[model samples]
Target: MLQIKDLQARVEDKEILKGINLEIKPGEVHAIMGPNGSGKSTLASVLAGHPGFEVTGGQVLFEGQDLLDLKPEERAREGLFLAFQYPVEIPGVSNMTFLKTALEEIRAHNGLPAFSAKEFMKLLREKQDLVEFNTSLVNRSVNEGFSGGEKKRNEILQLAMLNPKLAILDETDSGLDIDALRIVAGGVNKLRSSENAFLVITHYQRLLDYIVPDVVHILSGGKIIKSGPKELALELEEKGYDWLREVETTE
Candidate 1:
């Protein structure tokens, strides 16, 4: 559902993503693993149309549309979801209110009717249960005073409610206890289906133990240097990223 070809991007004068080529089809989960400053998150940010980064070269197509041409909100309305590495807090906006407005806007963009009050509540309940989100937090401000785990789960909750065709999870497992990690992963697993795809960016192999990506890619020097099956993550866990330097040199 998404295709990226020789995608290059830069922040100010320094280039980050250099010729990143990837394609994610529906029903597939792709994991990108890299060390610090490898531009893994930059790819996610670029895909989500972050204004800070400028697209210098190549193309990105989302469901055959030129993704780069759309504004960030337009991209979201088009079924592209980016779960931030650090989910920001909106002090005055309640979580429920934020999600309701987002969902309604997306639906309206696609010419769908807004959910009735009862219907909205029912849908909210289902998604909250799916993500194992704290119902009590629903009435609280978005990510305001939330723990790291709570913030991540809230991201998953938003993902569930939006039901985007392509979800880009940028370091969702960055901070969590094992139990919280399992809950978050479980929610993601349950949400997987033939109609949607996921691009997961993480640093550890442990995250892959639960999400079980269909493909694992090694990104370095702002380029995808290696891609293999899920077992690649295990190899990376054991061999470390240093060995990939040889791979990059050869390429």
Candidate 2:
């Protein structure tokens, strides 16, 4: 569903991703793990069209359409959802109102009439069940005073509501307790289907245990140096990234 070719990027003037190429097909779950400062987050930011990062070269295609040419909101309206590592808080907006407005925006983009208040609330109720969301959160301002776990839960709530064709989760496991991680992973597993794709970015193997991936890729120095099945994650956890470091040294 997504294809990235020779993707290179930078922030200010420092280059990050260098000639990175990766493809994710519909119905597949792929994980990206890398050391710090290896451009993992840079790739995500570039793909989402974050203005701070510049794509000096390469192209990203979502189902054959040029993705970088589209604005961030346009990408979302087209079924691209990215769960940020740190969720943003909007103090003046009620969560329910914000979600309703976002839904209307996406609907308008899709050539559908805006939902009535009752209709919007109905959809909210359904997706809340999908993510086990509490009514208290819906009543509060978006992400305001939410704990780390709560913030992660709120992201899943968006996933359930948005139903993006490609969900790029950047470090969803960070700062989550075991229980919170399981809850979040369960929500992700529930959302997976034959028609959607997942690009899971994580640091450790623990999250992979809950939401098993079809494939696991080791990203090093801004590029994927190894790709394998689920067992690769297990190996990485057992051996550490040192073995791969050794391989790189020898090569």
Candidate 3:
């Protein structure tokens, strides 16, 4: 569903992603684990077309289209979703309104008709139940006054609503308690299907315990130094990233 080739990106002239090459197919879940400043989040932002980060080289194709050529909103309309590590609060914009507008725009882009008020409410309720999202926060401003878990759940709620082809979750486990983590992961598992793929970026292996990935990649210094099965996460958890230095040195 997504193809990234030698992707390099920089923020304000300081390069973050050197050359990230990853291919995610439908029905597969890929986890990217790396230490701090390893360009994990930078890869996500670059894929989402964040204006703050400029692509220095390489190409990204989303389902055969030139993903890098599209704007951020265009990327979203094209079924690419990025859940931020830190979900910013948008004051004065109710979560319901924000979601409705976004969903309408995406559906229109896909040549689908907009949902009627009654249909939208039904979908909202169903997705809320699917993700166990807090209904009380629906009427409030997006992420405003929400706890960390609430914000993460809000992100999953958006994921459930949009039903994107490829969802890039940038550290969704950050700041989440065990219960919240389970809830968020459960929502993701439920949303999984043969038509969609997930790129899960995380630091700890605990999140992988809940959302089992088809492949686990060790990213260091903006490059993927190793790729293995799910057991790689267990080994990384036991041995830590230091052992990978030898692997990189050998390379």
lDDT (CA) per prediction: 0.96, 0.89, 0.95
Give per-residue CA lDDT, model 3, range 1-251, as digits (tens). 88899988899979888898899999999999999999999999988988899999999999999999999999999999999999999999999999999999999999999999999999999999977887899999999999999999999999999999999999999999999999999999999999999999999999999999999999999899999999999999999889889889998
In angstroms, give how far residue 99 of model 2 lies from its true place.
0.9
List the candidate 3 regions with Cα displacement exceeding 4 Å: none
Instruction: Tell me model 1's lDDT, rounded to 2 decimals.
Output: 0.96
Pairs in steric clash, model 3: none
Q: Against the true structure, what is each candidate's TM-score?
A: 0.99, 0.97, 0.99
- Report the lDDT tens digits of candidate 2 across residue range 188-239: 9999999999999988999999999999988888778888999999998899
Which regions in candidate 1 have their CA more than 4 angstroms from the true location? none
Model 1 Cα lDDT, one tens digit per residue, 1-251: 99999999999999999899999999999999999899999999999999999999999999999999999999999999999999999999999999999999999999999999899999999999987887899999999999999999999999999999999999999988999999999999999999999999999999999999999999999999999999999999999989888888888
Model 2 reaches what TM-score against the true structure? 0.97
Worst 10 residues of 3 by lDDT: 129-138
Cα lDDT, model 3, residue 71? 94
* Candidate 3 global TM-score: 0.99
